[model samples]
Target chain A: DQQVKQNSPSLSVQEGRISILNCDYTNSMFDYFLWYKKYPAEGPTFLISISSIKDKNEDGRFTVFLNKSAKHLSLHIVPSQPGDSAVYFCAAVITGGGNKLTFGTGTQLKVEL
Target chain B: DAGITQSPRHKVTETGTPVTLRCHQTENHRYMYWYRQDPGHGLRLIHYSYGVKDTDKGEVSDGYSVSRSKTEDFLLTLESATSSQTSVYFCAIRSGTGNSPLHFGNGTRLTVT
Candidate 1:
């Protein structure tokens, strides 16, 4: 069974608008959640993360909200830029145990400029 | 972009062949991981190492093996290749910080036919 799941395979948003990507996990042991962005021919790059303790974390134009009770999380990009168009991955990891990441299939975000 | 580097960025081989991918790090981080990215499957963990000669299997470790003989290098090998294993593989590294992000290498695209 998939511990962390991202039901959406793709999402589209207008430029200078808000882009939200959602993810869910089945493992309650997961203490940390992260988002990674990737472009063609490149590895994934770290975006932002939220700990199980806090419900949300923000960095620059990116913000992540975690709802532990629902095992759900969302990534929000305000005033989404064209450069933000790419595949976004949601990953989760349990604390104390060596970091074994469980990733969601991904959401291909298209920011129309 | 982080000190992580994966060698042989692309490879094509026939079935039953042996293939090995290498990940090297200059950051001297304590944790290293291997994962494969496929269409419809975001990124599945193959294996990870916590220290030199210390390793463990991840969610998807079948038909794969890993070894970390030194702190700087971790290797993933497929003893016998199969078409189903064709995918883009990535190597990642992380420190002990509970909130730190995982750094990634560009990736290696392997084709088995």
Candidate 2:
């Protein structure tokens, strides 16, 4: 069974617009959520994260919001640029669960000019 | 850059053969993980190591094995290759500290025919 799910397989947005990616999880034990950005031939890079204790966390143009009651989370990137086009993966982890991360299928984001 | 490197960026092996992928880290982090990425399945952990000579299986550990003999190296080996095992493999590391995100290596693309 997939503990984490990214319903959207792909998304497109115009430059300078806002891009939102959503994810859901079935495991209530997950206490931490993270978003990672991956280029075609590179490894995933950490973008932003939100703890279950907080409803939102923001960094620069990236913001992550968590709704623990709904077992859902979203990542928002404002003023999306061409460089933001890539595969976005949402991952979750249970605190003290040996730091094992469960990841979603991923959403391919394309920021168009 | 988290100083993570995955060797053999690409490999093609035949069925019944053995394949091993290497992951080296300069960070000396306490946690190392091996994950496989497939079309519909996101990143599923095969195995992980918490410390030198300490390891555990993850969600998909049936046909895989892992070894961590030193602080800087983690290895994933497929004892017998199969077409179903063809996928991209990623290695990740994280510090033992609180709520730290994982850093991933570029990845290794393995094709079994």
Candidate 3:
């Protein structure tokens, strides 16, 4: 079973607009959530993360919001740039669980000019 | 970028052949992980190591084996390649500290025919 799910396979947004990617998890033990951005033939890079204790976390142009009660989270990138076009993955980890991560399928984001 | 490197960025092997992928880290991190990314499945852990000579199987460790004889290297071996095993593999590293995000290597694309 897939513990984490990214319903949207792809997304497109205009430059300077806000891009929102959503994710959901079925595991309640997951306490930490992270977002990673990956370019073609490259590894996923850590972006922003939110702990279950907090509802939101922000880093520069990226913001992540968590709704623990709904077992859902979302990543928002404001003023999206062309460079932001890539595959975004949402991952979750359970606290004290040896740091193993469960990742969602991924959403391909295309920032258009 | 994290000092993680995955060797053999691309490989093609025939069925019944054995294939091994290497992951090297310059960061001296104590944790290393091997994950496979497939079309409908995001990134699934194949194996992981916490210390020298210590390793554990992940959720998708069936046809795979791993070794960690040293701190800076972790290896994933596919015994008898199969078409089903064709996928992109990624190596990740993290500090021993809890809740730290993982840093990933570029990736290795393996094709089994």
Q: Give per-candidate clash totals.
A: 0, 0, 0
Q: Which residue pairs collide in model 3, if any?
A: none
Residue A51 Cα positional deviation in candidate 2, in Å, after optimal superposition: 0.6
- Label model 3 with its docking quality class: high
The docking quality of candidate 3, as DockQ, is: 0.92
Docking level of model 1: high
User: A1-113 in candidate 3: lDDT tens per residue?
Assistant: 99999999999999999999999999999999999999999999999999999999999999999999999999999989999999999999986656999999999999999
lDDT of 2 by residue, A15-99 (tens): 9999999999999999999999999878889999999999999999999999999999999999899999999999999989688
Tens-place lDDT digits, model 1, residues A20-89: 9999999998998999999999999999988898998999999999999998999999989999999999
True-structure RMSD for candidate 1: 1.0
Model 3 misplaced stretches (Cα beyond 4 Å): none
What Cα-based lDDT does every candidate model obtain?
0.92, 0.95, 0.95
lDDT (10s digit) by residue, model 1, range B18-40: 99999999999999999999998
Candidate 1 TM-score versus the reference: 0.97
DockQ of each model against the real complex? 0.88, 0.91, 0.92
Report the C-alpha lDDT of model 2 over B29-50, residue by residue, as the tens digit: 9999999999889889999999
Off by over 4 Å in 1: none
* Highest-DockQ candidate: 3
